[model samples]
Target: MPLNEDLPRGDAEYLSQSCFQFHEVPGSKSVTARALFLAAAARGTTVLRMPLVSDDSLGFAEGLAALGYRLEREPDRWTVEGRVRGPAAEEASVFCRDGATTARFLPVLAAAGRGVFRFDASAQMRRRPLGPLTRALRDLGVTLVHQEREDHHPLTVHADGIKGGHVTLDAGLSSQFLTALLLVGPLSEQGLTITVTDLVSAPYVDITVAMMERFGVRVQRDGNTFTVPAQPYTATDYTIEPDASTASYFLAAAALTGHRVTVPGLGSGSLQGDLRFAQVLARMGAHVALAEDHVTVTGAPGGRLAGITVNMRDISDTVPTLAAIAPFADGPVRIEDVYNTRIKECDRLEACAENLRALGVPVHIGRDWIEIHPSRPRPAHIACHDDHRIAMAFSITALRTPGITLDNPGCVKKTFPGFHRALNDLRTIWHRDQ
Candidate 1:
């Protein structure tokens, strides 16, 4: 299992749905991964309720288990007996399997403990840059050896423990680099002070800091500088929120089909940055209602949508979701300031343009922007490029436009495994109503 390995394609079954009641999405993958790491590093048993059972999440939990942490799996929840310390194995091997969070964060977690650890991932993760975070860890006095490429994965770390001190991170490439540093900071012997330069996706850092606080650690933030006190994670019972990124697909479905769709259990109060996607839809003329426990979206009756010009740097994960609906907008939809998207699971900007163009939509791709002009989307087989977000986002287009088959629908298993089944259920309800 190396990065960029080919994956099998699956047919995306089209669902004819105009309206549907709220559907419960799975737990947040981001939150679930973070919580698992924290709980594993805590002092006692920690119960996590409603954790997502997806490839990426399960991969992370398995990686932790490989490092000698005890995890008891249940149907809907997980019980993890904390090691109360960083990984102590003499030599631990972790398989990231293209989960960038696991690949990035786990190394830092290992560096915070005593051991020699090696990390490798799927071919895709091997292509992603890990130099910045690796460099930052070295700056914090951890001996990191990149077993493969200089800044890429297949790396090994000889760790005594994190000697927490001041470090500066370049956040221009990916925000997860900053997040990985922050997550390991509290476990350092002297704590950690981080000065982030050229930060992108700042909201995601907010999530890391907030989750740290929930696990009984406070991150002091002043602009780009953060001070993390050396503290031990306390075990507790925690519940994960529904994934806002996964919910974006259904919300876009409501907008694309001129129907109402609701995703329950996540709304305005969510810590996930993708929740801002609902606001983007609202700005694009979809009727978006955010209650305390749920969020709903209703499309215009005639498939009319407003084109908007906005910078999506902080909420770049939803770029594909927005691109899916961009062709039907009243004017050109300009999404800018998302250069980081070029390095995601796929080069999202290029993938969006290529797929939309395949359907005869007028699209202009730039270094950091995509502008989609209103046009009819013809049926085309969308090449998902083995990227989960690309597959899920294009499924939104397939809802209204027929013959739009996703080449790698199985890729959604990385995050939302039951996507097609949930989608088909919508079809069942919508047809019965008809």
Candidate 2:
């Protein structure tokens, strides 16, 4: 459906070309979410530089405002004055608007404040499981009421502030659950000692801990047990790095087209686990270079890359990007340990297999793995399933293979609003003959 006063546009945008391009991608959505929440909890004022302006980040900023926190926004920076004690409102409703981070993290934040918060989500967000986080909150003495369904969204929290002692969290479903609890732990009277079981995507926990330290809160960790001391978060000016997950698409484009692409401000020094995606591309025969301030990927010789078998547990977000490039590989590409992909924005594993099949590629789907066998791809309409990753990942395939069209093109606005324009910029080349 088109916007009001805008007619439905015809024809699909086809991606093409081989050229060298350098682009600074948007701020990491993961980093932006953590920074926003930490800033809202910190004592005094905190400023975030180059924060992402996407639907997810904006949704978080707006939800905080609804809870009576003042966030002053500039074109590229955000200034938030922390209400040291917590949210000013005693009763508030936070609408996550399809941001899983917001849905998971806000409840815990509310529990630490002086209010009862009603958490609401989009139709898609409502379908996600919140048992681990919500149950853990209840055990910590926060009163949680599932307004609609148990372990699902549209829940209400009667927060008298969390006691936050010893608690165990089932981390199998989403790491954000652990991250949400960990973020609010330092504010508790007893602090928080959390023991995590069945923890997947463990690297994300490291990211949360690292960011907490940046805000003047130190989290003690030994094996699966984490202890956050009862301390106030000190406000600090922070600069967010470019999103490595978003950088993966352009890197994949270079791998597919035998060209060079560089994404500035994302490199080996970055805290994002998704930065390891460049390593996967390197294993697939792309020339990956990591500099102090940027990372670059040059296509394999003769525009052919070798397929690989990889365990994507630490970097599952790039599974779609790898799946898009798998068809062009010389052999089969098997992505393993990605069972969590199913519970994301959509059934990502099946969505990747379905879209690949639509493009005339043979794919084998397992309970936790996907194997893409090399086959000639034909033109097909790719269904994005409202997942931003699926939509962006397939755009890389469309560059070399002309017939790919995304069904829900507007879905890219969830993360990268300028994706199509950025993909088109690959056509700007300076030939030697000139």
Q: Among all windows of ten consecutive residues in candidate 1, which has the lowest summed lDDT? A: 1-10
Instruction: List model 1 lDDT by residue over 269-339, tens digit each.
Output: 67888888877887888777665566677777875789899899989999999999899898999999999
lDDT of 2 by residue, 5-96 (tens): 11111112211122444564889999999999999999999999999999998999988998889999998899998865668889998899
Q: What is the TM-score of each candidate against the true structure?
A: 0.94, 0.94
Looking at candidate 2, what is the lDDT of residue 206? Answer: 80
| Candidate 1: clashing pairs of residues | 2-122, 2-123, 3-122, 3-123, 3-124, 4-123, 4-124
Clashes of 1: 7
Off by over 4 Å in 1: 1-20
